[model samples]
Target: MKRIVFSAMAACMIVSACATAQDGTGLSKKEKKAGWKQLFDGKTLTGWHQFHAKPGSTPAWKAVDGTLFLDTDAKASGASGGDLVTNEDYENFEFEYEWKISPNGNSGVMFGVNEDKKYGATYSTGPEMQVIDDAGHPDGKNKKHNSGELYDMIAAPKFYAKPVGEWNKAKIIKKDGKITLFLNGEKTAETTMGTPEWQELLNNSKFKTWKGFGEYPKGKIALQDHGDKVWYRNLKIRQL
Candidate 1:
């Protein structure tokens, strides 16, 4: 059934050369006016690819029911795959997505990633807007590692995460060297990168030893594959 659906979609793409916003996966008129772009087109991994996986490797990621999700079954069966990333890079932009995690699941959204030999994972060079099952996950015991926290460097003032299996809205805005994080309509974390204060925060954190960490001014956006089931949708990005 998945193949049939995708085959029809493939034919449509061949005819139209690309899917349109009418599918609810492409940029809407208003979003297009705002210079926003669609990162995932819901039906296919058009602008995305598996990270660190060798050529012809089966991707652990899957598009299902208009949601892109990490297929834990594939990983459990040892169908190896890594993080997922956008083909194009962005420097400063506003990215928004809706996500839902399985019980005790762990995942993250990373930006400013310099995907090179120097970095093994996106988190090695990019800052992650932490995503996880805030209530059921072991990491939830610490506010610093809970959902909406800036991974480790910064803890959100309040936990606004919904329960696992429920959709949550998140936004990460980076502009002019300043970054801000929003969860469920509330501002959670904000900081200026490359400043003495930012450097101090980095020095105090676990990433301090990685020489290339957070040094790049621009790079790609990525979704971490922590060997857990997590679904993402409505992925849209606009340059700031």
Candidate 2:
């Protein structure tokens, strides 16, 4: 009878451990084992700060209800807001996040972002994973500007973004100069940087004249604030 009681207790403890691992806002047991780390703690903006803002300035972004969201009201009122960027720079890493955009919203996730004051904007250095309301945003009409594309350089074969207000999963992987992007479990774009093909694409794009665009091998990740409202959660990254 004592053996039976001990076995039941052990089973209950195992179940509890699994439940803790499956918490929505944190890395799962499998993810932790795979070397994934949370970029957003889901309760605070500890790991991020506004781009180009003075140190210790209050960020225009907010963390509420397990989401990191842009305060459009603050931005429209000219209350000190800009793109948010990670404090730590990453190179050759895989990043994953979930996002939901407001109607007609436009924003992006940029990687390889150089934070020097010389660059007026994040896009001047980093390449963006386009994020917009495909059905309402004007930019969505162009495949290259749609969500999950490599911004203006490489267009996705088809639209894979969910409707506005619905969360969509996005993944970006860069390893040894090769980059691949996925939207909602579908591969959206792939490219190899520092190649002739990459140069040709850059030369043909709007960033052709922008010095240092997509040239850095290591830089911070950025969340763009394009005068729109958007919510991001479950931001996690693992270095390759």
Which candidate leads the pack in lDDT? 2
- Using TM-score, give the best candidate's number: 2
TM-score of 1: 0.88
lDDT of 2 by residue, 1-240 (tens): 999999999999998788557566587787887888999999999989888888667666999899999988975565677899999999999999999999999999999999998999999999999999988999989758999999999998888999799999999999988999999999998989899999999998998888899999999999999989999999999999
Candidate 1 at 234: error in angstroms?
A: 0.4
Q: lDDT per model, in order?
A: 0.86, 0.91
User: What does the lDDT come to for candidate 2?
Assistant: 0.91
What tens digits encode model 1's per-residue C-alpha lDDT throughout 2-111?
99999999898866643334445467565687888888888888899877658877787999998998898987676776899999988889999999999999999998
**Model 2 vs. true fold: TM:** 0.90
The segments of candidate 2 whose C-alpha lies over 4 angstroms from its true place after superposition are 1-20, 23-25, 76-78
Error of 1 at 111 (Å): 0.6
